[model samples]
Each structure stands twice: as C-alpha cells, then as structure tokens.
Target: MQPFHPIPVSVLTGFLGSGKTTLLNRILKDPELRDTAVIINEFGDVGIDHLLVEQSSDGVIELSDGCLCCTVRGELVDTLADLIDRLQTGRIKSLSRVVIETTGLADPAPVLHAIMAHPVLMQNFRLDGVITAVDAVNGESTLDHHEEAVKQVAVADRIVLTKTDLVDPASREFALFTARLMQLNPGAPQISSHDEDAIAAKLFDCGLYDPSTKTADVARWLRDEAYHHRHDHVHDVNRHDARIQAFTLTHDAPIDPQALEMFIDLLRSSQGEQLLRMKGIVAVADRPEQPLVIHGVQSVFHPQVRLPAWPDDDRRTRLVLITRDLDESYVSRLFHAFTGVPQVDTPDRQALEGNPLAIPGYKS
Candidate 1:
C-alpha cells in the first residue's frame, strides 16, 4: 500500500463586502495553485467569470489556469469526501490543495471543524491555515458592530487588508484599526490585498511544516515573539473588541503530560466557545528531549504532534491563545494551577476540579 499524504486545506473567510472573492480570484491565478480545488458556497458568489473556462457535468468548474471550482451541493464534508473519492478513482486527474471560501457572515470555526473533527476527512486533509479579508474602509465599523467579523479576524492565520488603496496609510484611523487587529491577533501577519508580492506561497502553508524548507518551522509557526510585544492599546469596555483577547502563556519548567491533558480538558469543557484558536509547543516532563505541538480551533483539536527533537535552542513551553469573551487572567491561573506554580488567590488543580465554581471568570 502507498503511504497516505494528506492534502492541505486552506480556508478563506471574511465578513460581507470584505473582498474575500477578490483575494481568492487573485490567488487562483497563481501557477502554484494550479492543481488546487476551490470549494465555494455558490458560483455566483465568487464571480469567476474572467477565470471560468468550462463547467464539467459533475458541477465542477475548471478555471483557465487549471484550477477546479466546485460549489457545496450538500454538506462541506460530503463535498470533501466526493473530492477524495474522485481523486482515488482517477476521475480527477490531480489535487494538490483545497481552498474553502466561506460565506461572508459565516463563523469560520464550523468550517474549520468540518475538516478537523471529521474522522475520515482528518486522514485525507490537513488544515493549512485561515486567510481572512478585511475591508480597510469599513473594517472598523464592521468589527465594531459584528461579533462574527471580529472572530473572523481573531482566528485568522493571515489577514489580507482589502481596499487599502482607498485609505491613507498615515491616517490615524487606519493606524488605530491596524493596531486593534494586532491586539486581537498579534501572531497573524497582516498583508495588503493589493500587495503584488502576496502570492499563494506567502498566504498559505502556515502549519507546522514549512514547505519552502521541508522542515518543522516551530518559531515561524508559533510567532510567540509577536505576542510578547503585543500592543497594549486599551479598548472601550462596552465594545466587542474588549471581549476578544490574544495573549501568550509561557513556562520555563516542563509540564507533566497528565497535568497538561487535564488543563486542556478543563479549558475546552468550561469555555470552548470562548477559545477561538490556540497553538502551542510544550516541553513535556516525560519526554524532555522531544517537544509536543498542539493546535486547536475552539473545542476541536488536531492530533498532537511530537517532534523528534527541539526545533531550536528555546525549549520552554509557549502557548498563544486567541479568545473571545474570555479573561486572560482566568486562563493564566488555570495554567499555573496545573503546572503547580504558586500564585495568590488562584485555586489549585484539585480545588478547581472539586469545585468548578472556584474557577475565576467561570459562570455556572
């Protein structure tokens, strides 16, 4: 039997009028994305008239650049499963990658979960990353009024700022908007939609593996330094932005495997919805020589990956979390309790388990 190589699936999401289609159209033109299969909600929604070459009998639209576009006839999982079946049966010539373009107002978490949580899909597809489009002109107001928009940006692996040419980069409004994004998701790199250099290579492959080097690029994948230097800008207490928090949790000591599992379970069970996204590399006490990589979208987590050896000299545990309606202090205390770090007024692991009410910021 041949070894199974999972295809990488990238999600492109944004709020209404955010130019998600525009960015996706530009991305499909790239030669690197030639064999990519784009899954969209509707053909009309994407407006690929210029790129459309012909439509197959099975509802797959072949692009001029050798890309294939298919609409979701049923569930996303069904579409993905069909794609896999086609590939295996030789109905589809080849498939290098998959791009799922979500509806404008849709929460990207469900889309991510469809790929991550499904047992069969998990084996065939690996989450590449999330690319979110933000309209520069209305992004501020959109985020202010729409929690969905905020989440789209919060969980993004890469943010493409659209209509940037209309807004003056030197303006205070633009600066503040960008700063707000940084506060919401410090680790995600922001790119301008108009950036000619923002090609398929730059936008995709944000997982643990760096295709360019064919090695595990933990440092680039985690981007913990961005969180360390996160902007301390204050937001209005009543605004949606205030509810979203992005922060890093670090510990010098190696954590026990059991304790780590307990902590993750408690967090996921107690406040999974609030946990928009989390990715970390940990130093395990059992295997001090090897590091564990963990990535999760809300409650659904990809299988933990154990690296043979530390990627670099920095072996300390680093976890970056992007959460919504969740307190950072609460998470910090929970970690400290599990890691056996002493802190005043924080309940220990036993106490937390014994009395769930003891968890700070937790509502029964």
Candidate 2:
C-alpha cells in the first residue's frame, strides 16, 4: 500500500463582480499549476473558453494548460470525495493541488468547515489557505452593504486586489479603501491582480509548513505582529463597522490543556456564528516542549496537531481571531479566566464553567 499524502486545497472567494474568475483564469495559465484541479460552483458562471481543450463525459474538462476543471454536482463534500476516489482509482493520473472557487455572494466559512471537519476529506486533503479577491472599483461599497463581503475579506489568507489598474493608486479614496482592508485583515498580504509576479507560487502554500523550504514558518504563519501594528494607525471609529475585528491574544506562560479546552468549547458553543476564523499555537503545560496548533472556522475545528518543538525562540501562546459582532473584551476575559489571570470583576474558570454567562459581555 502506498503512503497517503494529503493534497493542499486553496479556496478562492470574492463578492459579486470582484474578478474571482478573472484571477482564476490567469492563474490556470501558469505552468507551475499543472496537475491542479479547479473546482468551481458552476461552469457557466466561470469563463474558461480560452483555456478549454476538451470536455470529458464525466463532467471533467481538460484545460489547455494541463489543469482540470470540474463543477460541483451537489454538496462540495461530494465533489471533493469524488476527486479522492478518482485519484485512488487511477482516473486522475496525478493531482498536486485543489483550488475551490466559491460563489461571489457565498460565505467561505462553510467551505472551510467542509474540509476541516470531515473525517475522510481531512485525511486526504489539508487546507492550504483562503485567497479573496476584492474589486478595486466597488470593493468599498460592497463591503459597506454586504456582511458576506466583509467576512470574505476578514478571513482571507491572501487578499488579491482585483481590477487595480482601473483605480488610481495614489488617490485618497483608494488609499482609504486599502486601509479599510488592512484593518479587516492585517496579516494577509495584499497583491494586485495585474501584478506580473502574482503567480501560483506567491498565492498558495499558506499553511503551517512552507512547501519550498519544507519547514514550519511559524512567525509568517501566525503573523501576530500585524495585529499589534494595527493599533499604531489611528483612524475614525466610525470609518468602518466595529462589528468585524481582527486581533491577537498572547500569553507567556504555558496553558493547562483542560483549561484551554474548556475556554475554546465555551467560546465556540456560545458564539460560533460570530467567529469567522481562529488560528493559534498553544504552549501546553503537560507537554511544554511540543506546541499544539489549532485552526478553526466557526465551530468546526481541525484536530489539534502537536509540533515536535517550538518553531522559534518565541514559545509564547499566540491566538489570532477574526470575528464578526464579537467583542474582543469578551474573548480576553474568557482567556484570562481560563489561564488563571485575575480580573477585578471577572469570574475564574471554576465559576465560569458552572455558568458561562458569568463572562461580562458573553451572549448566547
């Protein structure tokens, strides 16, 4: 039997007329993306006429650049499972990666949950990252009116500013728009759609381990520094909606595993819908030598992975959370309670576990 190797899956999402398909069309032409399977919600929605080579009877289209394109027949999980079966049965000669292009108006959390929570898909595939495309012309308006658009930008690993050529780079409006995106997602690097160097190499492989170096790039992966720097720039409180926030929580001491579990359970159970995305590296008291990594979308979390050792000298536990309509104080208080940090009026873990409502701002 051959050893199983999980394929890296990247999700591409954006708002209506955000140029997701345009970016994808360009990405498919890259030679490095060969043997990649592009799963789109609908074939009619995506314009792939220039790249189409031949269509198979099984609904898979062979692209001119050696990539494969398939539309979802039903649930995304079914489409993903079918890809796995095709790989195992020799139907797909080789599959290096999978890129899922979500519908423009869709919230990407459900797609992330499908891969992160499913038992079978989890084993065969690993979530590479989320790449969100924001239209330079109407992005600000889209984010202003649509909550889904805000969530899309908040949870992105790589934000591609599409149709940038149409907007003036030095204009005040464009600057404000870019600044808004930075506030929403400080860690994700923003790349222009027309950037000559924006190829497959730069957009993908945003997981814990760098494919090129084959090493855990913890600092780059966590990017807690970005959140810390966001405080330096003072902006009008009403400039953007306060409901969506990106922040980082850090602790120097190792956390008790049970306490950590309880804190996470309470947060997810009470406010899952508000939690757009959560990723962290924790120093556990039981095994301080090995750090545990956690990634989640809403309430669905990938199984905890214990790294052999701390990737760097910074052994402190750092959690980056992108939340919507969730107060940072609420999360901070919960963390303090679980970690045994005393607050004037906040209840400790023992008391909070008895009644989770004890947290000052927590709402269920």
Candidate 3:
C-alpha cells in the first residue's frame, strides 16, 4: 500500500484550576487513543506537569527541564515549528492527531494565531479547536475576576467543565452564566470532566479536518461525542458538576518511527506523573506499507500493532490523551524537540531517566 501523510492538531484551553489537566488525564486512558501524540502547555516560568504524564519515548515533548520558559512568542513559534518539521519531514513518527493544552492564564488568541499564521508552523499544523476548561465550583468568580478566564470561555470549540464533582449549590447562577457565554459561541461543543454528561453530544470528535479531505483537512483535535446531550442537559438540569469529562482525537496518516521513539522517550523523562492515559492509530512512514496502532497507560505503552488494512481509505491518524497538571504546550514540546534544534542542551534518554525533570513510567 502507499504511505499516507496528513495530521490534525487540537488546542485545549481553560482557566486556572478548571480541571483541564484532569479531563486530559481521563482521555489518555481510553482504549481507542492508540498511536496518538499529545502536547501540554502549562503557564508560568516552570512547567512541572510534563513530569507526570506517561507517553511513548517519541510521542511526548518537555523542554523546560521542569518548567515552561515559553512566555516569549519567538520561543513558542520556534518550538511549534520544530514539531511541524518532524511531522512534515518524516523525521518524527507520523502522528494521527496532535493534542495541545494551553495554560490556564494564557490568552488563546496569540496561540491560535501561531497555528494559523506562522509560516513554518502553519504548513503542517492546523487549529483543531480550542477546548476550554471551566471550574464548576469557582468558574463564576474566576470569570468575574480574570478577563483571561472570560476570553477562554468566549472562544472555545469544546468546553470541559472540570471539578463538577465539587460544585457548590450557590455557584449555580454562575454555572448558568457560563452556559450562556458558551451559547454565544455555539460553534464549539461543551463537555464535563469526571461526570458522564457529554455522552450524547458531538463532543467526541472536536477536530477541524473534514473526513472528506485527504492531506489538507483542517480540524479541532479533541472530538467529544456528547456534544448534543450536554446541550440538552444545560437547560433541563439543575446541577452540572457531577460528571467527569473525556473525549477522543482520531485521524488517518503515516508517521515517522524514529521521531515517535524520541517523543515517547521525552514523555517518560518529563511528564509521566501528570499523564493519565494515551492511545492512537498512526501511519508509519517506513512502514507506509501498513498502519500502526499504539496504546498506553502512564509509563506502560502497548506495542505498535499492524492493522489488516487502513481503517478507512483516507488513512488519517488518531491520538487521545487524558491528563492532569499537563496542557497542550507541555505535550507539544516533546514533538517539537524531535523536529527542531534543542533550545537548551537536553540529556539523551539515559541521562533523562535519572534526572529529576523526568516522570518515571514503563521504560519500554
């Protein structure tokens, strides 16, 4: 069979403590997230969550050693550009889907701009969708105090209501307000983390790619099947915080094996603890003859499997991650490291495993 080349990337955004990480953790555990790639971007000078997520040696990104110094734009673009190069050049494993997590405090517009406008970055990557996180308990006050929080909610393709298990009855009004805010931007779907609210909604496949297109499909990364169910519940339900959020990211394409190995290695070293679960269907460049299916829990990755034939003729790749303490940027760096020049000198796999910057998980 011929090789497939094309990928779909997703952006996850939310306010501080909105359960963005938690929702991500839940996603990684899905049996269906095999052969996927995940990027988590947390705010502040240090990115500690990368150390906790479990990923394949070549499927994860962690540049800060322990934190993120990505406050500057150039650094951010350079990082994303590198990941793109790996994906486009066959240096890194061809990823079926790219999952990105943004810091709670991040102004998503700039990040979106990078995905849409940057020359090197734009050619290979696309804005799947903005997955925003809101705290069911404190989200109301957060919106009132943090303009960034409001903006996060304002532009979301899918909203994951985190900490639904802990929402107070008093926060009902604000929760409703958040729902109204989302109603204003109905293009995106909304789901919850921990609670089973989004099961019937279109929250499952929140990507930007059109299933009809081949290489140039633009789509949001995270797709939640519960999009419609959640909308119905919003009006009829009294409390919306009792459920947990989870979703999927799927695609068809061939990935580079070497780059994937490096990406997974980085995940073990930096973000195992924060990583909850991961799975994906990948298109390997070397094995363009066939596709690969990958799956894993924190540190424990399933061996890549060869499918009898492409799930579909399009042959896109799919990757889904459920996480905590991690975001899209944190994860993106792993993919970036494989494709670009390392900003800081990083230890090879041997040294990284022993270093404190690493998250200890299943090594092989």
Residue by residue across 52-95, what tens digits does model 2's lDDT show? 89986476888887789999888899999998998899887889
Instruction: Show the lowest summed lDDT stretch of 10 residues, model 1.
Output: 342-351
- Worst 10-residue stretch by lDDT in candidate 2? 207-216
Sorted by TM-score, highest first, which candidate order results?
1, 2, 3
lDDT of 1 by residue, 1-364 (tens): 3545789899999999999888888888888897899999999998799988888757688888888899998899999999999889877788989999999999999999999899999889988899999999999999989999999999999999999999999999999999999888888999998887847787988857533344577777789999898869988877788888888999999999998998898888878988999999999999977888888988888877788888899999999999887888888877877787734354355676565447666643
- What lDDT, from 0 to 1, does candidate 3 have? 0.52
Clashes of each: 0, 0, 128
Clashes of 1: 0
- Between candidates 1 and 3, name the one with more favorable lDDT: 1
Q: What clash pairs does model 2 have?
A: none
Residues 138-210 of candidate 3: C-alpha lDDT, one tens digit per residue: 8766766776776666456667777767655357675576566544333355565665533313334543333
Please report the TM-score between candidate 3 and the true structure. Answer: 0.48
Instruction: List the RMSD of every prediction in angstroms.
Output: 2.2, 2.4, 20.3
Candidate 2 regions exceeding 4 Å error are 209-214, 232-240, 345-356
Pairing residues by index, what is the TM-score of model 2?
0.93
